[model samples]
Target chain A: MSTATQTMPSVERVVTPGKYTFGRIMPEALKYFIVITLAISYAFPLYWMISSALKDDPQVYRIPPVLVPNPAHWENFINAWKSDNFTLYTFNSVFRYAVPYTLFTLLSSSVVAYGFSRIRWPGRDKLFYLCIGTMLIPYTVTMVPLFIIFKHLRWVGTYLPMIVPALFGNAFFIFMLRQFFMTLPEELSEAARIDGASELGIFFRIILPLAKPALAVVALFAFMGTWNDYLGPLIYINKYTMYPLALGIQKLRAMMSQVGNAPLAYPYLMAVSTIAAAPIIIIFFFAQRTFIEGIALTGLKG
Target chain B: MAVATAKKWRLSKRETQNLITGLLFVSPWLLGFLLWTLYPLISSAYYSFTRYDLVRPPIWIGLDNFREIFTDDPRFWTVVYNTFYYVGISVPLGVVVAFLMASLLNTKLVLRSTFRAIFYIPSIVPAVCSAMVWLFIYNNQYGVINNLLRAAGQPIIPFLSSVEWAKPSLIVISLWAQGTAVVIFLAALQDVPRSLYEAATVDGANALHRFWHITIPMCSPIILYNLVMSLIGAFQTFLMPYLLTNGGPMASTEFYAMNLYRQAFEFFRMGKACALAWIMAIVVAILTAILFRTSGRWVFYGGGER
Candidate 1:
């Protein structure tokens, strides 16, 4: 067909399907049109959120729905922060919770994955299968019992329940890191072993450095997991003083919606949401592959 | 997962040392499985048969908790029905929306990555933030959707405030976060062989025909995967209803997890909550089993190896 078209352009024009021109272009155009509509609808809530955060409370409810705030009350962000302990929440989410959890999960899951992947031992396969099976157990099933156990240990009002689990590693991260470890050639570690590098030395000096990208993936996921986690904080953190951003934002709304606070603080609510969401949004933009790969890896669901 | 064996599975001296080292490395998982997973799982099940509060020891009560849940609690049934209603409509609808978005995304479009990023960014947003934004979006007097309706002279619909509209409204919120499934489906769509579509087109298949024939069948495994994941996630929908609706407007949005939270924490019906948890677990397991069993009929693996 290419040769014929090259030989005689006019014949090729005549042979081309006539019915597909308008039909094809219309669908192509319509496809994009539908895509734009879908994208707008998907993006509108987030856009509405940030835009409304810029609006005065009254402007949020204005007729015709302000697409952009003329004044752009940028102070709403700070006002929302000061209206509640959102700064405390932010600190808890990042410094207290997400950072520690990410570091611990990266180290713990990597160590476990190294065991499952690079080492040969009896009962290893069974244990790896057990790790996979643990993923199937829903969190709700454990919620009741874990709460009881934690309460017994007087951990209900503390961050221990949430943070302690990370030191043990997540099954999903373990499975993910193990898959990454399997792809590395055994020779890398074997050569290190031949050089009298201890097993821990090889893991720390060779494997960990080589697995930096996967570690970043795991670390980002671990951070986001706790950063976005609501149930964990809701269960463990009793005092409003200790609530992470996820739970704290909800409390901010509730406090703002209390009696005598007429004309709901829509701007404050959106402002809090935007503040809570900013880290995730920034992370998504910077490490988009982390989100994409994390989703694909956990596609089968836990 | 295979490991080369030495001396017909008997460990040599070096192998024994490796075993100790490997066990040390995996001790976190070993301890977690026992303390975190196995112990809690068994205790949770055990607690279901006992009437216990935080202050009191768990008193053995046999299947009375289960019996009450089945025969006495009317709200429990409502919660179950609400969960099924949400899961039934939300899961299938989520898959459709995700597939539609993914299919649209899979096409040749300029600025594709920006659009893909736009579509996917929502799924990563914290659930509480998503809930807060949707709460404001569904505000009857000022919500964007309601505002649009008002501008067009239509009566404003109370979203989270109405019984009839609340569950559907929450479902819409759920559909917003289907970006995970959307990206997954997009990846799967990219993997689908283009030659299959070309072959279908040569045989006079139109766009819809090619879609139903080539796309659906080719993407069946991914469709099944998204279906399962969406179902599980939907069944556990909590944070949205809790934050936005608080399972209000007549408990219309009181999903499984929300009710479980209420029983265990708010009411301190720990035994009853444990029972609810076990019941949900069994239902989820049964549903997942049924899905996988029936999947063989619909899910088409590439290379045709069943």
Candidate 2:
């Protein structure tokens, strides 16, 4: 087992098959063609989203649909922003919800995972397994009762219901970080302890620094989960002012109908969707290695 | 002497200190489980046997909600059918598509990461955002799908609005996010020992035969993993239908979760909703158990242990 910081490139290089023949070349070309086609199809919707966001109302309805925006309507973004209280929604998403949620989830889950993986104690494995077992219990089973509990605490309308839970640690994240924590050599912690370092000191000085990649993965997942959470906000926060980008975007189309806006709202709505999706897409590009590695590790170990 | 030994075994001082430290570190999750998960789970079960709305205290009414769900509620059956329809079609199709894409990407190619990222971007997109985008794409008039159809001289199909098209439309939306599965399968495919394929090739086995015999079996464990995961996900389908169509003009796409949500919130039927939730949990558990049981026949671990 290696430190979490060690990068394992996912691509495996296979030995090239003997000689290239026309028979092989034809199939190889065909394989590339199919792969390209699948890639194009997968990317097409995202392309349409951006292009449609740029097209003006009339151009959007052109008989032969425009593959690209001829004159990109950057103003559509302005209109989309003005169409709803998206500024408020964006603030709620970033400052009020995602930032705090990600921070708490990453910090707390790491601490819990360290306890489970690094420290030896009676019933440690059993307690960790108990935590893992809860993952199989679908959230739907608990949604109604939890809603009632929050309501009784009068936390429903506030961000507390969504934000407070993250401090408790997520089971899946605990499992992931614990797995990564276990991979680091135990001798480092042992050496730290022999030097008269406390458990907290060892965790903070040695284990935490070594587990940056895994911590980053956990943080990324927490950010994404909080950013895209629909049902949580939908259930707990009833006021329009508390809506995150996900629920806010869901309400945009209906709000248009209530305002008796023309059907040309499609382009503007597309602009809003593009705005909502851009942060995640940009983050993906920047953190491509972390994102791919996280997915691969979870798949392998899950 | 035996009594003294038993007393000594109870808690050595060092063991007591270790236990205290462990408990202190894990207290956050422990407290959370006690208050949030365990309490809610037990209460939900208790509430399922009672008649309660939001305002009134729950009144004991054992099996009534279950009886109504099984026999009286027509919408319950409709939701069951719709869920099964979505799960049956989407899970297998998603697995095949993911496996195929993974296989294609496993070959030597240029900019493999770029291709992988392109496929994966959709899965990371916020579900509500993707639903909104697809709603526009599936718009009957002045939408991409309709425009393409008109150009091909085909009739414009009402995708989100029409009962016939809504469920299938939702399924198509789900396929857009199968990139997670593709990445998983690609990792699994790469783990398949290349020497096995070479040995088969030396034995004059063609590419198809090698793939059929070696690739599929080696990846079967992951296939089962993906299958069970997708099955559970499909059963809990909510956001797409909720955002795209709001369960549609005729409840055509009213998935089980959507119906459960509506019952709990919209209709204020808390007890019945709890019952529905319990039933969904049971179905998921049973399906997962069945998959695990049958996995012994097909799913092959690398070490030859069933």
Candidate 3:
């Protein structure tokens, strides 16, 4: 084709199909349109959430549904905050989801993943497979038995049941970190071994520093999972004061269920949803560059 | 004898040293897994065969729980049917949507990262929050969706509240959250060597034909992986259904997991829930094995022997 076009430019222009010109441009235009539509569709619900949260209950349900609130009800957030015991709930959420569990999952899963990924010991491969096997077992199957176990241990209605499981290396996190570790050059560790460095010493100085990307991925996923987890807190943590944001927000719905014929407040519920979602949104914005990179890398591995 | 003894002692000491290190590294997970995962896993199997409530001691009644689940309970078959309906419909839909989104994002367009970020924005919201948003959208009286319908001069359709629309509503919600799968597919799509497209173009193959012959074949292995993963996820679909309908409109969305939750938590039917759990696990394991077997024929690996 190149040779033909070079030989006779005008003849080539006449011979080539004009119908195909539109075909190329049309597909590109359609692609752009679809991408734009999908972006709007994906973001609309979240936009609605914020708008509805600020609007009055009556105004929230207005016909041709209002896109923007007339008077921004910033007070709704403050009112919901005070009325819903959000301060206590936020404290509980932080304690359960962020503080104790974050450090616990990071410290614990790293140790376990290090053993499986770096160590050469008896039954290593077998034990590693056993850990991966847990991923396939649905959480539904284990919930009932675990509840009973907790009930027996007198651990129900407390943060212990929820917090304790995170101390274990999650199977998904282990698998992910292990995949990243396998990609690291063995020569680094080999040199450390020759220097009479202990495995723990090498883990601290060599592996830990090199594995920051994987560690960040681990921490990001753990935070997201723990933050979004509803079932754990619902089943195990029974007391109202012990509720995390997930269960607490759901409880707001439960309260709405009893308010009779009158319109229950929309602003309060919206405020709760926004508040609950803020941390994740902030985390995403801060770590987005690394987060997407991690996602792209992990997605390929899977 | 003394030399042999000394050598044996040295080997034993080294073995003990390795053992100690291994234990120290794994102790956090080991202790927690035994207490949480493994212990529960094994005891759940035991609990399946016994009759027990939360307060009472587990009674030895072999096969009774299983027998009841198979023959006696009305909800067992209903739950299974509902679960299969969700999984069977959602997995293919989710896969197709994901692939389409990936293909769109794969084009050499401007603001590609922005496009990727925008599409993936839905996944960042917690499932419950999205469910709450959908609940408002699905409201028949004053919902944004109904208002749109009203403006269009069309009849309002009851979404989550209607039994007929409940499953489809859930599926649609799931498709919105299909962003994660799309991200995976997008990464996989990049690996489809650009040379293949160039070759196809030279051969007078159009975009559709090129996609059919080259792109699909190259990405088949990933498609299979995503299929199995999504199927497993869809089967255990709990969060959205739990938050949206609470398995309502007369248990219209009473998925197998939701049923298990009600039995264990609400009714305290520990034994029966355990039985249901075991059934779900077996089904999942069997389905996973089947996928693995079938995948070998279709899934293309890099320059490897069939």
Winning candidate number (lDDT): 2
Q: Provide the TM-score for each candidate, comma-separated.
A: 0.92, 0.95, 0.91
Cα lDDT of model 1 by residue, B15-82, tens digit: 89999999999999889889999999999999999999889899999999999999999999999999
Candidate 3 wrong stretches, greater than 4 Å: A1-20, A261-264, B1-24, B30-32, B304-306
Q: In model 1 chain A, where is the ten-residue run with the lowest total lDDT?
A: A5-14
Candidate 2 lDDT at B296 equals 91
Position B84, candidate 2: lDDT: 93
Candidate 2 lDDT over residue span B1-306, tens digit each: 787478675877877888888888888999889888999989999989999888998999999999999999998888899899999999999999999898878877888888999899999988887887888789887778799999899999999889899989888878988899998888878777778887887888887897899899998989998998888888888988988888876878999999999989998888999999999999999999999999999988875533
The Cα error of candidate 2 at residue A8, in Å, is: 6.2
Quick one: ranking by DockQ, best first? 2, 1, 3
Compute the DockQ of candidate 2. 0.64
Candidate 2, after superposition: displacement of residue B302 in Å? 1.9
Residue A105 in model 3: lDDT: 75
DockQ of each: 0.43, 0.64, 0.35
Give me the TM-scores of chain B across the candidates.
0.92, 0.92, 0.89
Tell me the tens digit of each residue's lDDT in model 2 across A1-302. Answer: 32323333343434466888888789879988898888888898888888898988778878878888889989989988887899999999998899999999988899999989988888999999999888878788888998888888999888898889889999989998998998988999889878999889988999999999899999998999889888888988889998888878878888776778665577877888899889899999999888877877766765
Q: Which one is best on TM-score?
A: 2
